[model samples]
Target: MAEQASPEAKYQLGTPENKQFLDEQRESLMAFGHRFPSPGGSSYWLGDDGTPWTDRNRETWITCRMTHVYSLGVLVGHPGAAELVDAGLKGLRGELHDDANGGWYPAVTPTGDYTPDKQAYAHAFVLLAASSATLIGRPGAQELLDDAEEIFLKYFWDAHEGLSVDTWNTEFTELDPYRGLNANMHSVEAFLAVADVTGDEGWRDRAGRIIAHVTKWASENEWRIPEHFTSDWKPALEFNRDKPDDQFKPYGATPGHGIEWARLITQYALSAKIDEAEKQRLVDIAEHLFARAVADGWNADGAPGIVYTTDWEGKPVVHDRMHWTLAEAINTSSTLARVTGKDVYLNWYSTFLQYLDANVIDHKNGSWFHQLDCENKLMTTVWPGKSDLYHATQSMMIPLRDPSLSISVATKEG
Candidate 1:
C-alpha cells in the first residue's frame, strides 16, 4: 500500500491546491490506475499486541479496508484516491488463486510468501474489487476476477441452498462448513456487482435466492437471524456469547445491528424487485435500525454513532467506537432518503455528518482517525498513530457526496 512510503514531507492537497493537484497527480493516477490494492499484503511480522503481525495476519486489516474502498470508490472517483485505488485493485491480483487448491489463498506478503487461510467472505470482497477494477478498465484485473469467481463458486457456492458459506479450506476437504448472514450478504453484493458488469442473469438469479433466503429467515424467526449454524440452518448461539457483547441475540435490537441489518436495503435497493408493500417493509426495517441505534447506542454528548453490540433490553454495550460505522450510517440513511425521497433521513444524516466533520476528522493527519474513546477522545491509549490510509479508504466505500470535499489533506507547511 502507499502507506508503506510513510508520511513524506506532508505531500498534501485541499480546496486551494485542487487545481494544482489535479494538474500534477491526476495524469499520473489516471495513467496507471487500478494497479493493486494498498498495503498490498506486506509482511508486518507483528501481532495485534504490537509484537508482530505474522506473515499471514498482515493481510487482515489491509484486505478488510480494501473491501470497503472498492465498494465506495467506483463512483466517488475523487482525484487523489486513484493511487490507493490502483494499489487495492492490484493487491487482489497478487493474493489469489493456487493450483494446489481449486481457489485462491488468503493473501501474499510483499516478499511473496502465501498464507493458508482462505475465506469465501474474503473472496466476496473480490466480487466488488474485480468489478471496480473492471469498471476502471484496469489491465489484467479480469484474470484476477476470473480466479476469484472460480474459487468462490467452486468452494463456497451451495447450489441446493443457493448461498455462499463463510470459509473454505484450500484442500476442498470440508464442504458445507459454517454459514453466516455476513458472508451471504456480501456474496450477494459481489454477485450483483458482477451481474451489473456482465449483464449475467445467472448471477442475479442466484443473488435473488440468497436474498429470498435472508428475508425468509426474517419471516420465520423473530427477525433474529442467527450467525453461524448447522447444515439445516439451525441457530448457533454458542459462539455468540464469546463476542464482545455476550449473547448478542439479533432480534428486537442490538448495537450497530440496525445499521448493519439495514445495509441490505442499500445494497439491493436497486433490484429487490419488491412491490410497494415489500419496499415499505424494507424501509421500515432500515428506519427501525436507525431508531434502535439512536435510542440505545447514541452518546448524547458523543454524537450519534451506534455501539458495538446491544441487548434484548435495547441497551448498547460498546467495545469499539468505530468511524466506519458512522460512515455506513451515512451511506445507508442517505441512500434511504434518496430512494424514498424522504427529507427526515437526510436531516438525520446531515446532523451526523456535521458531528463527524466537526469533531472526528483529524486535520493534521490528512485522514479520519480510527476510533474515539467513550470520553470522546482519540483512542491513543490503545494504538498510537494507528491511523490508516484505508480507514479513510474504507469510509469511502459507500460513495459519499463530494468525496473530495469530505477528504482531509495534510496542510502544507509554509
Candidate 2:
C-alpha cells in the first residue's frame, strides 16, 4: 500500500498546495522535455539527467507527444514553447511523415531508414498533436490536422465497425491481422481533442462508439479491458503470455489502461451531447472501471505502487510499477472525485501523489522514472529511457482542468 500522507504533506485534491505541486511538476516537465527535439524535428528519447539518447530512433508518437506538450506550454505562456512546437511540426511534416506513403512512419531509424509499418497508435498521436497545435494557431497545423485525419480515416479507422484497425504495410495495402485496444484508446483521446478543436460533433460521436465497445468489454471482464484482439476484434487473452512484458503488447489485463479508460470515459460522458441521465449512466460505468483497476492493481503484491498487468482472475502478472500507470491513477482518481463528489476517490488521488513523490519522481533527474520494480526500485527493463512528457504532463494538468474539456483546450481557455 502507498504510505500514509505525512502530517505536513500537502497534496490534497483542490487545495492550493495541491495546485502548487501540480504547477511545479508541470513546469519541471516542460523544462525536462525542452531537449526532446532532434535535428530532424522528431523527438529524441531522453536519458537520465535530461540528455537526449540519440542512439534510439526518433519516433512519430514521441514527437507528436512533445508537440502536444509544447503546444500546451505555449497556451500556458511558457518561454520558448512555440519553437519546440514548431520543431515537432517540422518533424511531423518531414522525416517522421512518409511523403511517399499516405500516413506517418512509426519511426525514423538511426541509420536514416524509416520503419516498415504504419501504425494506428502513432497516427492517433499525430491527430492529437495536430489538434492541439491547431488550437494554438501554430503554422501549418491545420494542414497537418487535415492530412492526419484523412490518412487515419482512410487507412486505420473502420466506420463500419466503429473501431480503428491496428497496422498496415507502408503502402497501406496490407493490413495486419493483429488488432489492439491501446491504439483505439488513444484514438478516443485524439477524437475528443479533434472534436473539441474543430467543433465537429461527429468526432465526439465516434469517440462514443469506441467507448461503448470498451465499457461493454470491461464490464463483462470484471472491469479489466482486453488489450489484445484478433483481426475480427475477438479478445486474444493469451496472445502474448510467453512474452508477458512485451512493453507495447503485454499479456493479460493492463490495469493502467482501465484507469486511463475511466478518465477518458468520464471526459466523454461529460462532453457528449447527451441527456443527464445518459451521462450519469456513463459516469457510473467509469466509476466501476476506476474501482476495479485500483482494487486489482494497487498493492496487489503488498507493494507501494500499482502493478503493470493482471490475469483474468485479477492476479498480478507483471509486478513492475510503470510511471504512466501511476500518472493515470492520479488523473482518474481526481477526475472520479470531481465527477462523483466522492471523498474516497480524492483520497486515492492524494495517495497516488504521495506515491509519485516517494517512488516515481526523480529528484536527481527531472522527469519521473519510467519504470520501477515491485519493490519500488528503479528499473528500465521495459522502458529504457524517459519517453515524452505527454502522460506525466497531462497527469498534472488534467486535475486542474474541467473534466469535460480536452487538456489543450482547457489550458487555452484558462
Candidate 3:
C-alpha cells in the first residue's frame, strides 16, 4: 500500500505545472505515434525510439487504439490528426476487415498472412475507435460504428447473460468456449463511448448490467476480480496457472484491471440517470475496488511499482511493472479524488505521478518505457516495444478532464 504524501506544487492534478507537463507528454506521444500507420493503414508496432517495428504483425487492436488516440488528438487541436484518423479508418474498413467473413481479423503479418479468429477484444477496440472518430466527424466512422455494433451484437455479445462472448472462428461459424473478463471490460468502455456519442441510453444500461455482475463477483472473491472463465462463465482460477506470464490471459487476479474497472464503474455511475443512492453505492464499490488494487498490487514486492498479476489471495505473482497498469492507477486515483473530494486519492495521484516521472517515463525518448522489473530497471519480457499510444496518451489527458464521460467525449466537452 502507498504511504500518503503531502501534495507538492507540480505533481498535484490541476496545478499549472501539472497541466504543462501533461500537454508536453501528450504532444510527445502524438509525435511518437505518427509513424504507426503502414501502407495498408494498419498500425505498425513502434520500437524503443518510436520507429515502426516492421517485422512484427500489424494488429487490428493496435490500429484501433491509434485511431482512438488520434481522434482525441483532433479534438484537442493536434495538427494532422484528422489525416491520421482517416488512415486508421482506412485500415479498419479495408485490409484488416474480413469482407466475406464479416468481422475483423486479429492481425496481418508482414508477409500478408491473416491471423484467424474474430476476437471480442479487437471488436471492442473497433467500436471504441469508431465511436471516438465519429465524435471528431471523421469520414466513414458512422458506417464503421454501425457495422461494428451489428457484428458485436450478432457474434460477441450474449444478450441473455448481460455479458459478452470471447471469440469466434474466421467464418463466424464456430464459437470458442473460453470466456474472459478482459474483453468484457473493454466492452464496457466501448459501450459507454457508444452511449455518449450516439445518445443511445440502452448501451449505457447494458454496460451497467455487466458492471453489476462484475461487482458481485469481486465482492464475493474479496475484491480481486477473476479474469478467465469457463464456457458457462464459471471462474477458471487455474486456467493459466502453469504459464502465469501469458501476455493476454494470466493465471489469477489482475490488479490493473481492478483499477481500470473502478474508473469505468465510476464513469458509468456518474453518467447514468440513476438515483442518488444508487450512484453513491456504485461510487463506494469503485472506491473499494481502487483500494483493493492499490493495496494488493502497489509495492507488493517491496518495490515501487504495481505488479502485473497477483494470486487469488492477493499475493504478487508477476513482479514486472507494466506501463498500462500505472496509467490506470493514475487515472483511477485522480478520478476517485474528483468524485469523492478526498485528499488521500490526490496524495496517491501525486505519488504515482512522481513515480512515473522518476522511473517509467523515457525522458530522452518520446514515450514511456513499456515494462520494468522489480528493481525499476527496463525489462522487455512481457511487453517488448511500445505497442500503441492508447493507454499512455489517455493517462496524461484523463486526469485533466471530467470522469463522467469517455475520454473521447470528455476531450470534446472539457
Candidate 4:
C-alpha cells in the first residue's frame, strides 16, 4: 500500500501550494457571481447541483453578502466582478430598499412586495456590504453606507444596552422582544469594516462597547455564549429548547458563534490600537473563548467534526455539523496562530484544513456543502443548498492578510 501521509504532510498554511489553493478557491467563489445577481437582488438559494433557484424571494442579507464578496473580487482584479458589485448596489438602492420606511426589507418577493419585518441581522450585513463597496470605490456606495448607519443608529441601536435590537417593523413602529447575540456579533464586524473604510474611530469604539458587553456575558457563562436573549438584554437560556436547530434562532450555546466571536474580538483589539494592558485583556479573553469552543465543540459527540450547539453544561445538544462552524474554526485558529505565534493553533489549523478538504469541499459542486450530519454525510436539515459564499470565501481569504485590517482593505493593500 502507498505510505499514508502524516497530518503535517497534508496541508500547511503560508506555504506556496496553500497560497495557490486559496487563489483557486477564491476564483471558484467569484464564479458564483454569474448565478447570483438579479435585477432586484441576489437569488436567495442555489441548488446543491449548481443551479440558481430564483423562484424564492431575494433576501437583503444575501444581497449584502454577495455585494461584499464581489467587492472583494473587484479589489483583487477579478474580471466581471465590478458589474456584479454594481448590480448588488442597485439592489440595495432599488428593490430591497424601503423608500417609505427608510430601511431595507428583510426579504422581497419577485413581484417587489417585501416582508414587513426589518431585522438588525440583515441591516448589519447591509452596512458591511456598503462599507466594502465604498472601499472598492463603487458609485453610490458611500450614500448607502450613510443611510444604513443613520437607520441603524436611530432605530436599532440601544445606547443603554450597548447592543442592537433583534428586529423591528418596516416602519420602525414596534420592536421584537427577542434579543440575540448573533446580530450584535455581526454588528461588531460591520462596524469594524465601516471604521476601516471611513477612517473613523467612532465606529471602532462602538464595536468595543458591544464587545465588552458580550464578552462579559461570555465570561459569566463560562465562554459558552448564550444565543437568545430578552428584550431587556437578559439571557433566555431556555429559549427554543424544543427546537435546538431552528436555523437562525437555535437554542442553547452556539459553538460557531463563540469561535466567530474569538476571531472578531482579536481583530478588534488589533485594529483599535488600545494600550498594552487593554489589548492583553482582550487577547486573554479571546484565547479563553477559542479554547472553550474547541473543547466543547470539536468531535464531542463521538464524531470527527464539530457539533452545532451544546448545552450550558458543555454537553452536545445538536449533533449535526455545520459547514460555517468549521469555517469559523479555521478562521479563529488562523487568527490565534498569527496573534500568539503558537504552534498549537497552527496544528489545529492544519487538522481542520484536512477535515475541510476531505469532507466539506464539494469538488463536484461549485461551493462547499452547507451542512453535514454527525457521520459527515451531506444533509440539509439546517441549511438548504449553498445559500451564499460569505463564510467559506472569507475563511479562505482571512488567513492571507493581516488580522488588524478588514479583509477587503487588507486584500486591497496587498
Judging by TM-score against the true structure, name the best candidate.
Answer: 3
What does the lDDT come to for candidate 1? Answer: 0.52
- Per-residue lDDT of candidate 4, residues 179-257 (tens digit): 9988999999999999998998888988999999988999999999988888788899999999999989998998899
- Model 1 TM-score, 2 decimals: 0.72
State the lDDT of candidate 2 residue by residue for 200-244, as single tens digits: 988999999999999889888988899999989899999999999
Tell me the tens digit of each residue's lDDT in model 1 across 216-309.
Answer: 5654544544455666666565545544433222323343444655655445545555577876776666565565566666663354445555
Reference-based lDDT, residue 238, model 1: 54
What is the TM-score of candidate 2?
A: 0.98
Q: Each candidate: what lDDT?
A: 0.52, 0.92, 0.94, 0.87
RMSD to native for every prediction? 9.1, 1.3, 0.9, 2.5
Ranking by lDDT: 3, 2, 4, 1
Model 1 poorest 10 in a row by lDDT:
405-414
Residue 292 of candidate 1: its Cα lDDT? Answer: 52
